[model samples]
Target: MSKKKGWVEQTDGYLNKTPTFQFILVTILFALWAIAASLNDILITQFKSVFQLSDFATAFVQSAFYGGYFLVAIPAALFIKKNSYKLAIIAGLTFFSLGCFLFFPASRLATYSVFLIAIFVIAIGLSFLETSADTYSSLLGPRRLATVRLNISQTFNAIGGIIGILLGKYLVFTDHNLQEEMARLSDAEAIKFGQQVLQRTLTPYIYVLIVLIVMIILFSVTKFPSGKVRKKSGEIDSAKFGETMNYLLHNKRYWRGVLAQFFYMGVQTGVWSFTMRLALDMFPHFNEKYVANFMLYSYICFFVGRFLASYLLSRFRETIVLTVYAVIGTVMLIGTTFIPNMIAIYLAVGVSLLLGPGWPTIYARTLETVDDKRHTETAGAIIVMAIVGGAVLPVIQGLISDATTMQFSFIATAVEFAWVAWYFISEIKYDIRSTVTNKSHSLED
Candidate 1:
C-alpha cells in the first residue's frame, strides 16, 4: 500500500513541477499551426478548380508551403537559441498574422502564385511555432513523460484541424457546383465568379489573422518562465551553437529518426492533400462541402486516436506502439490504393487513426537521445525541417496522379509508411541486442 502511495506521490510531483499556465499557452501554439496546416486540404481542392490546374500544378501549393519550413527552420532555431521561447513564439505569431493578412491581397488579385506566396509565409510562421512549441512542451515535464505530454498537446492540434476544415467547408468551398456552371458562362462571367469565390476564401483567413493578433497581445502581457537551463552564472549558454550542431550531426539515432520523420510527414501530407480529390473521384455526385465534412470526420477520428494512443503509451513502450501503428498505416494505405468505391474513402480516413501518433512519437523518441539542453533548439529545428517531406512527396504524388490515376498515386504514401515501419523494427532489434550485449558484459565483469 505504501509503495503504491509513493508512486502516486511521485506522479503528482512530476505534474506539479510543470508550469500549468505556460504549458497551456504553448499548447495553444500547437493548435494554431494545426489550423493553418489542415486548411491546405481546402486550398488544394479549391485552387485546383479556381485556377484550372492539373494535379501536378496544384501540388505546388504544398511545395511552396512546406518549402518555407525547410528554409526557415534552422534560422528559427538560431533565433530561439539566441533569445527565449517566449520571444520566439511572439515572432512566430507576428509572422502568422502577417501571412494571414496577405491572403486578402492574394484573393483580390486572384493569382495562384500570390496565394502560394501567402501559404509560404504562413508556413514560415508555423515552422517557428512548431520548433519552439514542440521542444517547449517536452521541456516542461519529466523526460519519461515527454511522449505523453506531446501527444496530449497534439490532441489540441487535431481539434484545431477539425475547426479549420469546418470553416473551409462552410466559407471557402461553394455548394453551387461552380465547375459545371462556369462551363455555360461567357469568359467575363466566369472571371467574375472566380473572383467572388476567391474573395469568399479570404474571409476565414481574416478571422485567423484577428485571432493571431489577440494571441500575440495576450502572450506579450503574460509573464512566462525563462524556459532555459541556467549555467553556473545563471545565464543561458549561447556559445555552444556550433558544438551542438556537430553533436546532432554525429548522433546516429537522431539522423535515423530524422529520416523516419521525413517519410512520416510525406505520407501524412500526401494523404490529406489528396483526400478531397479522392472523395470527388470516388463519389462524383458529392459536393465539396460534403467531402469537407468527411475531412472533419477524419480529423475527429485523428483527435480521438491521439488520446487513445497517449493512453496506450502510458502502458506500453512507445517504439512498440509506434511500430504497430506504422504497420497498420502501411496496410491501410495499401488498402486505399487497391480498394474500390467508398471502401477506399473509409480506408483513407482509417489511415489517420494509425498516423495520429507517428509525429509526436518519432519526435519524442529522437529528442530523448540528445544529451544537451542548449541544443534543444537546433535539434528541434532539424526535426521540423523533415517537414520538407510534406513538400516533396505530395508533388511526387501529384505527378503520379497526373500521369496515371489518383488512386494509383497513393502508392507513394504506402511506400513511405512501409519505410517507417521498417525503421521502428530496426530500432527495436537494435535495442534488444544492445540490452543483451550489456548484460553479458556486466556478467563477465
Candidate 2:
C-alpha cells in the first residue's frame, strides 16, 4: 500500500522530506503565476479609459485574456500529457515571460487591441502553467500533503496580486489624466502627451520584465522535484483530444467536478473582476486602495480556507464539509443580495474564505474516484474549464453592470453559487452511493 495517509501524517513527512532550495524556487515560480494571473485587475480602469469601452467591451478583455485558456488547453494538456512535466513547465514559463515582455511593446504602442493581443499571448502561456504547476505541486511530496505544498507556494501568488494592484494603482494610473488631457488636442499635440503616458508606464514594466526574465532563467536552471511524475509519450494523435473529451463526458464523477469547477470559477471570477466597480458603486466611502485591500484580505481568507481544509476535511466527511461551506457561501451571497451597502461588498468578498479548500477537495475526491491513467487529461480539462468561468462569467458580469447597477450584478454571481450548492448536493448523494457500494464490495473482497 502507498500508505493512504491523511494531511497531518503528510505534513509531518513533509517537514522531513522537503528541501529548502525547493521552497525558494517554488515560491518564486508561484510569484510569477500570481503576477501574470492578476494583471487584468491592476489595469481595469486604464483599459476602460484607453479603449473608450463600455463594460461589455472591457468584459471581453477578460474573455480574450482567459479565452486563450480554451484555445490552448487541449494542446497544453496534451503537451504535458505526452511529455515530461518538466518540459511543459519550461515551455510554459518561457512563453509566460515572453508574454510579460509583450506588455512592454503594447505599452509603447498605446494600442488597445495590441494590449488585448498581448494578454491573449500571456494567457496562452499561462494555460500551460496553470495545468502543469498545480499538478506538479501535487506530485511533489506525499500525496496527502499536496494541498499544503500548493497552498504555501500559492501565497506568493497573492503577494503578487498585492504588488500588481499597488503597481497598477500607483504606476499605471499615475499620469492617466495627462494622457487624457493630451488626447483632447490635435493628433500631433496628443502624440507628445501620449509619449509621456507610454514612457512613465513603459519604464516600470521594463523593470518588471527584466526581473521576470531573470526569474525565468533561475527556474530554468533549478531542479524541481517530479514525484511519481510519469511523462506520457506517443504521436500527436489528434484523435486523443476527441477521446479525452468523450472520456470526461462519459465519466459522471469527473463531469460533476467539471460543473463544480465551472460554478466555482464563476464565483471566484465574479468577485475579483467586479470588486473595484462594485466598491465604487455601492460603498462610496471606500476608495480604490480600500477595495484593493479588501480583495487582498479576501484572498488571505482564501489562503486560510485552504490551510484549514487540512484539518477540516480529515475530521468530517468531505461531502458534509463541502455542504456546510456551500451553504455558508450561499448565505453570504444572499446576504449581499439584501444589503445595498458596503455590508454587501464585505460579505461578497468574504465568501472566498469558505471557498479556498473546495477546489482541492473536489480534485482529491474526483481523482480518487476515477481511473489513474486519466489524471493528466482530466486535470487539464478541469483547470481549463475553470478558465471558461473566467472567460464567460466576467464578460457577462461586465455586460450586466453596464445594463443596470453594479448592485444588481450580484444576481449573476448568485446564480453561480447556486450551481455550486447543487454540486455539494451531488457529492452528498454520491457519498451515500460510495458508502453502500464499498460495504458490499468489502463483503465480496
Instruction: Give each model a TM-score.
Output: 0.92, 0.81
Prediction RMSDs, each to the true structure: 4.8, 5.5
Which residue segments of model 2 deviate by more than 4 Å?
A: 1-28, 174-208, 224-246, 283-290, 432-445
Q: Quick one: how many clashes does candidate 1 have?
A: 0
Q: Any residue pairs clashing in model 2, and if so which?
A: none
Error of 2 at 435 (Å): 5.6
Error of 2 at 410 (Å): 1.5
Per-residue CA lDDT of model 2 for 1-445, tens digit only, reads: 1222221112111222555565566566666666665557655644654545677677776787778877887678778666755667677777776776887788778877877887788778777776777666655566557666766666666677656666656665552243245458887766656555555455445666777677667767766543333223422222356665666677787777776776777777777777766775675545554556666666677767766765787787778877788878877877776786778888877887787766666655665554544445545446554667778887788878888877677778878877887887877877888799999999999
Instruction: Name the runs in model 1 displaced over 4 angstroms.
Output: 1-16, 430-445
| Model 1 score (lDDT) | 0.83
